[model samples]
Target: MKIAIIGCGNMGLAFARAFLKFDLVKKEDFLLVEKGEDRMEKLSSFQPGVITGVIGPQIGTYDLIILSVKPQDFPSVQEALRAVITPNQVVLSIMAGVTIANIQTVLDHKAVIRAMPNTPAMLGMGITAYTASPEVDMTQLRKVENLINATGRSVFLEEEEQLNAVTALSGSGPAYFFYVVKAMIEAGKKMGFEESVAALLVKQTMLGSFHLINTADKSLDELIKAVASKGGTTEAALKQFEAGNLDETLIGGILAAQMRSKELSKG
Candidate 1:
């Protein structure tokens, strides 16, 4: 199938690379659109035969269009696409707050799939949550799912509003993990390890912890209890976290992200 990707930014490039890596789309059948000349050059270097440019009359030739442009840039992209996008072409958007209805209104197209994916998609480990307009059938939805799954896992939502919660959780979740890892590395350094060694220690600890969580059948609270024996060092740290209300603060932050996501969609 002919596929066109607009923006060609980090997320776009990640998807492009994944598509090429998985042999999901031929290089000749792929189109990359980016306004920046430098980005076009980079894409050309990365995938030699893919076509790159702003949206034009030729856009109608593609069966699928993946919109990866920033939400702020949608107006300009929409205007450029107004004359070219046809009802038959499907649009799968990964812009954080751009809803399928918003895309439909802006581009005057019906088949739209809106998705939220995180930075981990660059490593093919991201989880994308998506919802589609009624105009998209199950066959088209499955195709979009396969394309998205090239980067990582994908889930479908019955209610579009749930995307706001997904945006708060997995969409911005990587940064939360990184924030804690940064603190852990600093704590290691304060305990007398070198900077590089501290980073290594914290990184491996995180990886091992994730592995344990994935492989074990125990619930998260049970796993925590397994490590935090009464009156032990783990318990001591747990007390500190509880005293600081860390859980409440984290939940509040995620809710704030969801609120911001809703506001962005409105804009």
Candidate 2:
């Protein structure tokens, strides 16, 4: 299938690389539209059969198109694509906040899909949340899912509105994980370790904890209880966390993120 990527930014390049890595689409079937000369040079070095030129060439005559441009540039993108994309072509938008209905309005009622993917997609470990309208059939939806699944795992949302929650969770989730790692590292240092030692400990601890969570059949609270024996150091830390209402704080943070996502989409 012919595929075109409009932005060639990090996410776009990531998807392109995953596509090439899996041999899902032939090199000749892909076209990249990038304005940055240096970045374009980088893409050329990858030896993918990517035509770096006007969006018009790439937008027209493509079976599938990935819209990865910045949200602010979408007006010009819509204007550029109005006469080019046929009803048969599908538009998969990876922009954070844009909705499928808004995209279809721009493309004159063409098939449109919205997807939210995070930074880990560059490493093929991201989870993408996508939704499609009635314009897409089950077969077409699976085709899109297959392409997205190349980058990482994917989930379909029945209600398009839940994309906001997806944005708050997986979309911004990587940074949250990193933030936790940072806090762990800092706490380690405060407890009298060298910076490098603390970093390594935190990293390995996180990895091990992740493996334990995956392998263990116990619920998270039960696992925590297992570690926090009565009146032990772990129990003391848990008490502190409970005193500070960490759960409430986390819920507030996620809600804030969801609100910001809604604001971006409205913009």
Top lDDT prediction, candidate number: 1
Clashes in each model (backbone N, CA, C under 3 Å)?
0, 0
What TM-score does structure 1 among the candidates reach? 0.96
For residues 1-267, write the lDDT of model 1, one tens digit per residue: 889999888888888888888999887888888988998888777663466676888889998999999889888898889789988999999888888888898888999999999888988998999999999999999988998998899898999999999999999999999999999999999999999999999999899999999999999999999999899999999999999999999999999999999999898
Candidates in order, TM-scores: namely 0.96, 0.93
Model 2 vs truth, CA RMSD: 1.7
What lDDT does each candidate get?
0.90, 0.86
lDDT (Cα, tens digit) per residue for candidate 2, span 37-79: 8888989998777767576744678888888988887886777
**Highest TM-score, which number?**
1
Tell me how candidate 2 scores on lDDT.
0.86
